[model samples]
Target: MTSTLGFAILAVLARGDRTGYDLATAMRRPIGYFWTAGHSQIHAELQKLRSADLVGFESEHGPGPQGRKVYHLTDAGMRALRDWVTEPPRERPERDELVLKTYASWLAEPDLIREMFADQLAAHEARLAEYEHHEASFDEPPAFGDPRFGNYATLRCGLSYERHRADWCRWMLAQLGRSGERPIGR
Candidate 1:
């Protein structure tokens, strides 16, 4: 995660001071969950950021407990983030496993394909439910330009994606002559 992806972790640190665990937890929110790095990856990237003077941390020592490091963005980190934001992004190849499998589905057993798509549909539904639960915490009709608006907007992205994925999986099942739609779980 040392390259541009590492910058994603840096962007999170820009928010405020966080321990490695806190950083990982922040990532589990809509933005981080969508483009993910595990806790170890976050820790590794933090070390790199520290080495480059982009981020700094203070160690809190206790009498009988292990020390904890709380990380914050250095001025260099802010400059780098500002610079990176203006850089044009490189386009990467699409590598979705489901799409790849669909391309070769004719060669596989029909029943297996049906089962796989069914499982995928169910997963998307579950994710949608989780996102909906998170959405409940927002103000009813969140105000424009508010901080919570950004959070709600990202949550909407996740919700839209899960809904589309679930619908696509059902469509695929129908195309394969299998019934796929299940009762929508609230």
Candidate 2:
């Protein structure tokens, strides 16, 4: 199944009845930054799911909007989600343009590379602050403290990634200084 199909299945099962727009909004809140599906993509995927009998839709009654379609996951959809979850994922291919660019330009312009690392460090710190804000305000906070937190595993993973980036940046900056290069961005 495609990523969009998997997302549609999960969205519908999480909430019993949701319009296409509602599903898009739901995706944006928790997983949008990670998954990044457009509204048109979601609508198209929903149509495909309906055609495959993996989902069902119903018209709303006494609604301000006439004949809005609310979608729900079928039994088949639930089973599909279960099967996908259990299946081992394929290896993800690495393709980071920023890293490539940094390494490519490093020999010619080491100072520029140092500046790039410094910039990345700032960006990572900003992201960590944003994650901390979400952890505090989100209805479901990260599992750092609370035992009942359901998404703690994923949250911890994100925190670890951010920490790694921050640490790497620090090490890179120290190496720059040790080399006696006129500090980056000077």
Candidate 3:
């Protein structure tokens, strides 16, 4: 079966053909914001898609990509991508390290936990600021069917998620300060 990464490769190809290097650049930008895959992982997935008959490629003839493959979606790949687009996404298991830390935080000093959350909040805020700048750069959202529409929509979601995370961190900080939270003795 084609993996989710395979579909990601196909999705990129749907926009247009690209060499592995170009695809890596695209992945690092908007897609990397969500679905992260390393350069090697993307290449491996491309090979898998080729084996599955989901993608095709021509010999690349660019500077970096000299003699490399410029991959493109096959008809079957397009059909599979369209079908996957509408189907509900599978639920990924929640494995956030900070959330896990939060679960066991009572075992650590409250101040240390506060520091961690503070750092997290700052990171989230920084990303939020960048996303905001990007959103402002767009004169308007792309109309549906534009590939840019996908980028805009995902940025909006990232905005919401960052705000929510920052708010939660603030709440945690407040609780840490009040009532003089004490860590449980080991």
Candidate 4:
């Protein structure tokens, strides 16, 4: 079975052939599970995908000491990606630390909790602003077949999430203010 990282690599190649460095940089972006990966993990996945016959690379002369390899999806890789795109994704369990903290927050000091939520609200608003600015750059949404369409689509979801999260943070702060006594935990 192909791993998600394997598919992430293929997706980047689907846009165009890229060196491993390019693929690593692309993975550090607007969406997806690969963001936490370092360059070594990305390079390892590329080799695994190559071994699985999903990707092929060409040796190139470059300034780097070992030179570079430009990777592209094979026909099988393209076909696999097309099939995977339509299939329902395997859902990973949601493990949100903030929500967990909120559940346990009644034990903490209300002032400190308010400070934390306020910081969180600010962060969400900042991210929302950045995504909105990027969305505004396009005259309209890119058409579905265009590679940019995927980027635009993911960005829309991010904007919505940030808005909701910021709203929730505000609500939490308001609820905390309604109480006269401080919470128990620090």
Candidate 5:
């Protein structure tokens, strides 16, 4: 995953040279909102990319502060990014702490489990609202209407995932409430 993100960062830099902070900010703009890596993580990954010769850096003079080291993607980085995008994604390891914790608490503290579900429901509701905002902004199907289909697809995925989460959370909360076991919180 780090390698993949490294390639993405490099690809962004391929457009033009940018400082570490600038790179991090650029990542979160529209592309980063969906495929996000933290600032520290981006910095670390940039170092790794540099060591791998996927990117090169040069110090540039600036007005408000000291000179900054700006990175540019190398030819190797472009090839790497292309290969990664074309190749099949590797299987992701499953290690959901929330699911494990919910299972662990189910027998001993069912009410707490219910409360957790309620909390998740609230969080999902907020996410659903955001998704709604995105949906409202778009007048037509993404790929059908826009040339930037890649970004549109990413936004669509986010909307779909949030909607699914909201629906599932609502169902789970209803089931928990009807189970005759009072929730842990009022």
Candidate 6:
């Protein structure tokens, strides 16, 4: 079975060839928003892909002991991703700590809960700003069919998610009578 990391690696390569370092750096933005992986994990997955003939790499001089290798998806890798996309995804459990905390928030101090909301509001706002900045970097003709459309589309989703979370934080603060100078409830 192709792991999520496998697909993520292929998806990254879909844009263009990249060294392992480049792939890890790319994961920090859009992919990191959804999934987390360390450099070692990424390297291991790349080795697996290479063994399976799903990806190919060209060695180039770099800082690493084995030097750097730029990876690109093979035809098999692209086909694997396409096949995976067409198949129905298996249900997996979510582990959202915020939601879990909310579920048991009744036992926590009200003031502390309000503080948490305030902190979350600030974080989401910061993320929204970052997403907006990324969106502004897109080139012209960034329509659905444009080459940079995926970047734009993902940025939109991140923006919307952060906005929604910020709104929710504001609402919770208002409900707790701790909105302070911030306006709430539209």
Query: Quick one: best TM-score, which candidate?
Result: 3
Highest lDDT scorer: 3
Q: Give the distance in Å from residue 35's predicted Cα in candidate 6 to where it truly belongs.
A: 3.2
Candidate 5 Cα deviation (angstroms), residue 34 = 4.3
Better of 1 and 2 by TM-score: 1
Instruction: Compose the digit string of candidate 6's lDDT tens values, residues 1-186.
Output: 779888888888988999988999999987776667899999999999999999999888787576778999999999998788668877889887987997777767778888898999999999888888877786653777663676666777788888999998888888878434443232
lDDT (tens digit, per residue) of candidate 3 on 18-120: 9998999999767866788999999989888998899999985666644778898999999999999999988989888988998888898888988999999
lDDT of each candidate versus the true structure = 0.81, 0.69, 0.88, 0.86, 0.75, 0.83
lDDT of 2 by residue, 1-186 (tens): 556445544644555678888888866644533455778888888888888777888888636756788889888877777677667876888887766775664454667777888999999888777766666765654454453353445445666777888888888878876776443353
Please report the TM-score between candidate 5 and the true structure: 0.79
- Residues 1-186, candidate 4: write the lDDT tens digits: 998878877888999999988887888765442234678988999888899899999999989688789999999999999999999999989899999999998888788899999999999999889889988998999999999998888888888889999999999989988875764755
Estimate the lDDT of model 3. Answer: 0.88
Better of 3 and 5 by lDDT: 3
Clashing pairs in 1: none
Regions of candidate 2 where Cα sits further than 4 Å from its true position: 4-12, 61-66, 137-150, 180-186
> Under the 3 Å rule for N, CA and C atoms, how many clashes does model 3 have?
0
| Residue 155 lDDT (model 5) | 69
TM-score of each: 0.85, 0.73, 0.93, 0.91, 0.79, 0.85
Which residue pairs of candidate 6 clash?
none
Model 2 C-alpha lDDT versus the unseen true structure: 0.69
lDDT of 3 at 43: 90
Minimum summed lDDT over a 10-residue window in model 3 is located at 60-69
Query: How large is the C-alpha RMSD of every model relative to the true structure?
Result: 6.0, 4.9, 1.7, 2.2, 4.0, 4.9
Global CA lDDT of candidate 4, please?
0.86
Candidate 5, 1-186: lDDT as tens digits: 347688678767866789998898878755654678889999899889988888889998976689888888888887887778678887889786766775565464666777787888788778668667766776776664453555567767877877787787677767777777644453
